[model samples]
Target: MARTTGSHSDITGPRVRAAALSLFAQHGFAAVSMRQIAREVGVQAGALYNYTPDKQSLLFDLMQTHMSDLLSSRDKLPETASPLEALETFTRFHIRFHSERPEEVFIAYMELRNLEPENFEAIEKLRRTYEDQLENILRAGVSEGVFKVADPKLATMAVIAMLTGVNTWFREGGRLSLEEVEQIYWDMVRKSVGA
Candidate 1:
């Protein structure tokens, strides 16, 4: 990677990344080009190399950043909270977080096939960590007889899929507020677990 020459590389670097992420989300990663990303960022083509080694690195950065934010944004549920409470918390969090970042969510799912093998594995690991949190909650519910989930792992995947699907057609003013969407999804999740 080339060292950034300009003092404004600090600002320019993020702008470059933002441009890359936006373009990658709109046009598939394979269809986008380094020069296009540079053009979007209003930088010379060579200048993009100062911020990233290659376009793949830019894609990896966007994916890793999104996963990191998803992992860190989850607050630990209260120690004394019941299984149902923990489940509700996870339901609401998944919906709210993914709904707020439609572009990131879209790219995260849509561009996984474009990732290099190692980058793909890293992203998958981070996603699995998030899945494990919900699976554990489901397991706790099953142990407590509060949920009749036959398979915690499958239930976790299903519930997450159902919740994340809200981003596809949900607009803020399109008949349902975000809170209502969250509540509706939460209710479906609650019933899905047989709680």
Candidate 2:
């Protein structure tokens, strides 16, 4: 396809992804059509092909982008920091990050079964990388005798599940602020690990 000077992929690409993310979050991956996504982007359906080849590719891209952003934005816990400090950082960061992108987070979990095998593998790999960050923190904390976790791997899964569960029920003005929620989760995470 010939490139048009005004129809830039840089601008349209993200819009396409965002539209797809919202649609897939609102309707299951099986239910959302490329034309609906194109409408959401205010472009013709054919224009969507300029950004993604097909719906499967678009879903994979959304998931890949979500996981990539997750890995990139994760806190870089310093070696000098204590296990408790590292854990608190991870806990708070996890809650806040997931909360900020409820749609992406929702699709990330809800649409996993929709991914092709290769795409599923790629997303799972990125998920493991994110999980490993906390696992290492837990291991370090245990080694330092600051945490009494029975299994770092299991604890990593538990902490992530507990933190992510917040997005399902949390609202900005209903009861507590996100900061307050983070504090409460931090306390629970700390005690769960016996910090």
Candidate 3:
């Protein structure tokens, strides 16, 4: 079983989660089985049950972990940062993080439909938390006259959609470095808000 404490267990959970995330991303949740995930993780099929009770639980766990990591990482940013700084911080962090964990991003976005109704609601709540963070930054920028967006919520969704779309075409040897990509996105986002 994957324990909650210790470095060893910590590593195991992420490894299992990553394997599951990649599989789910490549094949929709309904098409993936515990055996498939175990094969990817190099464990016996039955051993997969040690980490999660069932397939739905595994999907929920993956989404929960991804959401929690995102929120926790965002929460670590400097609290007193300006609105523009906050948005930039979030944008840069998101771009870099998603680049490093494309499978998780894919699973988070695509496999949401596989969740049971209760699980879906819980995941949606966590998702809204992340969205609210972006909205908060946008609202702050509008309040301080640094940004001129008419609707912070709509603006937040637009920026997130544009930023997340990078995962679709981004390649390791692409012409643009991650920093350059982030800068391009930052420019577009800033201009979109009338910064």
CA displacement after TM-score superposition, residue 17 of candidate 1 (Å): 1.8
lDDT of candidates 1 onward, in order: 0.90, 0.91, 0.85
Tens-digit lDDT track of model 2 for 1-195: 677746688889889988888889888899999999999999999988988899999999888988999889978766688878888988998998999999999899998999999999999999999999899989988998999999999999999999999998999997899999999999999999997
The lowest-lDDT stretch of 10 consecutive residues in candidate 2 is 1-10
TM-score of 2: 0.94
TM-score of each: 0.95, 0.94, 0.88
lDDT tens readout by residue for model 1, 19-48 = 887888788899999999989988889978
Tell me the lDDT of candidate 1.
0.90
lDDT of 2: 0.91
Prediction 3 TM-score vs. true: 0.88
As a TM-score, model 1 comes out at: 0.95
lDDT accuracy of residue 76 in candidate 3: 63
Error of 1 at 192 (Å): 0.6
**What clash pairs does model 2 have?**
none
